[model samples]
Target: MAGPSVLLPLRSSPFRRYLLGQLVSVPCSWAQVVALAWVVVELAPAAMGWVVALQFLPSLLLGPWFGAIADRYDRRWLLMAAEAGLGLTALAYAAVSLTGGLTLPVVCLLSALWGVINALDTPARRALVPMLVPPAQAPGAAALSGTVMLIGMTAGSGLGALMVTQVGVTATFTLNAASFLADVALLATIRVGPSPRLARAPRQIRDGFRYLWHTPRLRTPLLALSVVATFAFTFQVSVPIFMRASFDGGASLIGTAFTVSMAGSLVGTLVAAARGLPGRHTVARANLVMATAMIVTAAAPTVLVALISLTVAGVAWSFLLMSVIALLQTAEPAMMGRVMSLFALVLLGGTALGGPIASALAAAAGVRAPFALGALAAAVAVAIAWPGAVRPADRSSRHVTTADAG
Candidate 1:
């Protein structure tokens, strides 16, 4: 249902290039992800959670500092440097695997290294959007960005599985390594106004935290996200565990259900994109829908019903995420980098924690327990935030800037 207005952001040449480049880069990245997951699951299923945790731990530990860097430096250069690092890492992975040097410990180390580069890259990439387009189109741009990930999910998952099976892991890693060069090229062509170069202050990161803590419009949505995102958004780790435990990792069934969920995410993104930005109450509704889907996934007696529920969950989760991004964009442009970095912080931090939490809960209870716990946490958080969520979003600017407190 994305109409002409929804496509307005595409008219920006810089955004167009960025979107197109990501179209190529994202799927490749996804292919590597699937290949990597396959390696972990096959080699040491017991270590999957630790591997996942290592892969995202940098985001939790180093995210705010990198976000400060994003606020202070040219995002384009930072992104390019990250891509270069990614390419090197991918080649290293391919070399190690092809030479039969791949192991659980090596994988953990490599995952951690990648996480460091990603922690730096994520905030910069996220904060770059408003620079590419006008503020009003931020919602549409946000929607488009979501599409990039879904597209990756759609193409990347299938491709990843296929390549891992057919072409072998080294080829898959090499393929993704090549994509980074293309990304770097595209990023070089992008034109933008100067990035904010904040002065070297000791507490720049703390200022970001303080700004987020005080801004009700900013704080409430993230508060809801802290719960929902920590639980619902960790599908990558949970679903895999679910498949391995419940269905014994039936490849066809997992693929079918995962693809269905991606389709649902596609639907969710379109609906949210069409609506522009939803109010806070709407976000609460999305939470309930997602919680319901997770419950259904937990309780369904048959695979058919479980698959259907995942699709629905995907729809609701994607819908809620659009609002999260759009709401975050409401922050002042000067503060946009830090705000988006916090968004990444909460998001990736949840991801870092989600894997271990899912593994522990699933081990103690049943495989389905993580989904149920996620549902309960999300519902409770949304309820607590509901009162404030009903308030209309404040449109007035806070005049917050990175100019050393004026």
Candidate 2:
């Protein structure tokens, strides 16, 4: 059967089912993230920095291993497990909160579990996109997914804040738990396309390291992106502190800032969706825009200025992230699951480390210092990735020499 049109993957078979599942799933996931962050802020005002840092610790620690599993297993079942885990994790958080025994330590421990589950879920869910849509429609499918996620994030963050304010954290946590349950039910019935047989798999775990190391197309972009992500994601953590200290804002205000930025991301995703075909210079252009926006963000003194800068940053964030995924898809479809798993590791793992370090620097230097440093890193990463972007060569061109291997 012919695949759905590039513009409307949502109008067809298996992809339509998956898209429906995602519509429900994305908002739930985003809601949980916002709620979890707010819960940490409430439980440990003294160590809000630490709580934020711990939230991403699992992605850093378990992402590579999960990637290895993604390469070696059926993605559908893996996603199901991940969805189920998220639901149960939500329940665990609810139990702690409902019992009126919620503590920072317990929340941290639970967040760690959520992190591991997230690490597994992210790559499989992302890499599975191509399976649902045709190769020609991959870019469109990606943009569709991005738009849904951004909208969901915007809605989820905004609603979570309101839920927390109007009702209680208990209600928010219960609702988050329900979202995961809903996602699980949606995923159970969709028909996933072909995945590589792993029964007699190559030592893909070890080869994955080798594959990444030897591939200039993959390694160069990945490493460069990691550098940029470390800085950009640091900004993600820094926003809360900046809002509280610089603007004297509270949780609701912080949520508003995130919601606004997410709006920008939504716009950017739509633009990308309209483009349809993946462009060669997408990453380079996105990075340049990102760097410019970050510089503006660092210098902005007023809340309005910061919000505008953040909106720009959000746009660049969406484009560059979608571009990065496009690059991965262009490289090797068979290896996508594995590569994406590792991609999640670096992206999120870097965020975990970046958050704590950025917070510490902000503490030692000033709130604006992290943004300054982040902008500089983004600039450099863009510069490094520039040459490769122009060449548009194969990622696997580089080879390991005996001397280097030794």
Candidate 3:
């Protein structure tokens, strides 16, 4: 079998162009998150949890609607609109804060709106990748996308922290808003094939959900992913509180932790891009690695130690996420938009349902408990994948490799 380097040339220029667009926008989103969270802490200290919750609320409420939109509309325009909306929302946030009239309710509304934009943007952005990249290089493209996202996140988080401390909250928000304009420019430059044409069938949304539900392999991976994300999503959501309560650290520490984890993500994506996992077995192996990392992360006693643990977790995270993406993309190229919409819905559900559970658990039982339980959930999910790991016909060495990979 050939390695990823051998397959590198398969992707097109448009793939890289789109990737660059994401590189600009994703980090912008993360920077705004850092800014928003910090502002909430400063302005409405007691209701920070609610503010964070508002950020993800749109994903939960309108995820299916967004998925339908991804299938129904031209993805390029959808992505551009989402990026611009998010940028404008950040400006709104800045305007309120600069005027000394910022309110928690207003922040919540803006955050929810941001969520709506994300809902529309995420599926379109994801669905476009396979169309741009060749089938052989899809895994590499996914890894590259993950790498860009993490890199952006690291820079944005770190920069937002510095801006808040040195400049002010308003400056950080303003820069975040600016990042959207830059994203729009980059997106405008990328020319992709026309999006798939959908039929004007009477029950299109119902058909999308039905198609997803009936596909066993798709259903299985999505279910497993949901279970895993339920716990894993907590890392981003509750980490700020963890920094504040456990280490008595501030935004700088939060930024550093994210940066460190993103470094791990870079490592993971590079490895995935260089080597590539060829089969379902490889994906399973990656899931085991992810499960172990999460367990270790949950068990860490100190913030620095936890950060190190998160680095390992990040590697596992990227590998598993990419593998799942490759599997789904390979399975349904024609309906990539619909398949990814389902993927987006599952992710949204996991984050939305899990965020509050994680928050309440962290608030009540301490930060480590929810993390530990999350790790346990991951382990169990991996265990569930064991039965489908390999086929009976592959009872030889090839079968063994397949089983291990799964």
Candidate 4:
């Protein structure tokens, strides 16, 4: 018998409602990112690297603790409260900027606050998907989530630039705050079955770490993802610098480049979702493609060429991320929150470490230097992880009958 369509998860009312909320809020979040980055560049260009690093530091430090909370409590309420907290933070930023009191230090503090909220929010949000849809549709649901994020990012980058140029940074911040409120409202409408809560243990946070350490299936891919996150994900820092230094372009061009890359990601995510999740072998190849693309981006002589390379890199990135998420989600349903938090921790931790290093390299060598180093690092990661990653994933629980559909 034929299984459900790739878009089957969207048929679930709760999942659809959740996705719609993200469509509104994610773009706002991205717009805030663009505005904040530009704000940092304006205030202290040399500190841009540290600014980026500060945003992810909390996730590296507190991911497991938050994951434990998500496992023990209702994820839906956790997500709602997190969204409200994020909105309040954005409002505070807007108020500060409007009052002409926004400084580099303030920006860094707010960004760290945002990171803390995300550390609590991400695990619950990710772990909630499986509950919203059947197990078989989990991969498709994950891919769709990626697609929504990329599309939002694409729109937000472009719109953020426009807002910053015409309206002002305050407006961008305000929009982001409003978007979060909207997301909270939408989240209120979603109703899902209760999650299986774990009993209180003395060291519940350590359980996620212990699981990853013992489970080769989850551990290998996560380690690979961390490497990629550290090196390849430095594009947020690299791209704007590249635009200003190499192309002599301004905010608009940076936004355009981001949009092009996100468009590629959208395409790649849709393709992956429709075709079903790829195996570890495909993920390794995708990383190689990403490495090659970064090298190409570094060597490009013109802005047009760089944009093309970024698009290719985006495609490879989307594929790798979706594959990894699907693998983690399917591996252990009971420990989904903890496992996903570990994934977020590695990913964000890599960002925390890599952003500063890439920025310093860019400062010393050139803006293009980070891409070259990133390519090398990604290649090394592939070599280290390929053998384990290429082995077929255990998909024993992926099959779902129509009656079991959410």
Candidate 4: regions farther than 4 A off: 1-4, 397-406
Index of the highest-lDDT prediction:
4
What TM-score, computed on C-alpha atoms, does each candidate reach?
Answer: 0.94, 0.90, 0.88, 0.95
What lDDT tens digits, residue by residue, belong to model 1 across residues 74-178?
988898899889888888899999899999889999999998998888889988887888867777888898887787776777777778778888999999989
Which residue pairs of candidate 1 clash? none
Better of 2 and 4 by lDDT: 4
In model 2, state the lDDT of residue 281: 62
Candidate 2 scores a C-alpha RMSD against the true structure in Å of 3.8
Residue pairs in collision within model 2: 217-395
- For each of the candidates, the C-alpha root-mean-square deviation to the true structure, in angstroms, is 2.3, 3.8, 5.1, 3.9
Displacement of residue 350 (Cα, Å) in model 3 is 1.2
lDDT, model 4: 0.83
lDDT of 2 by residue, 1-406 (tens): 1223445667547777767777776666666666666776556533555665566677777776777677667887888899889888888888898998888888878877877788899878877777787666666777778788888888877887687678877777777778777777777777777676555455766666676666666676677678877776565568877777788877687777788788888887777777654455667777788888888888888999999998888888887776666566654665676678777877887787787777787888877778888788878877877777633344354233323422
Candidate scoring better on TM-score of 3 and 4: 4
- Cα error, residue 140 of model 2, in Å, equals 1.9
Predicted candidate 1, C-alpha RMSD = 2.3
Q: What is the C-alpha lDDT of each candidate?
A: 0.80, 0.73, 0.69, 0.83
After superposing candidate 2 on the true structure, give the runs of residues whose Cα lies further than 4 Å from its correct spot. Answer: 1-6, 200-202, 390-406
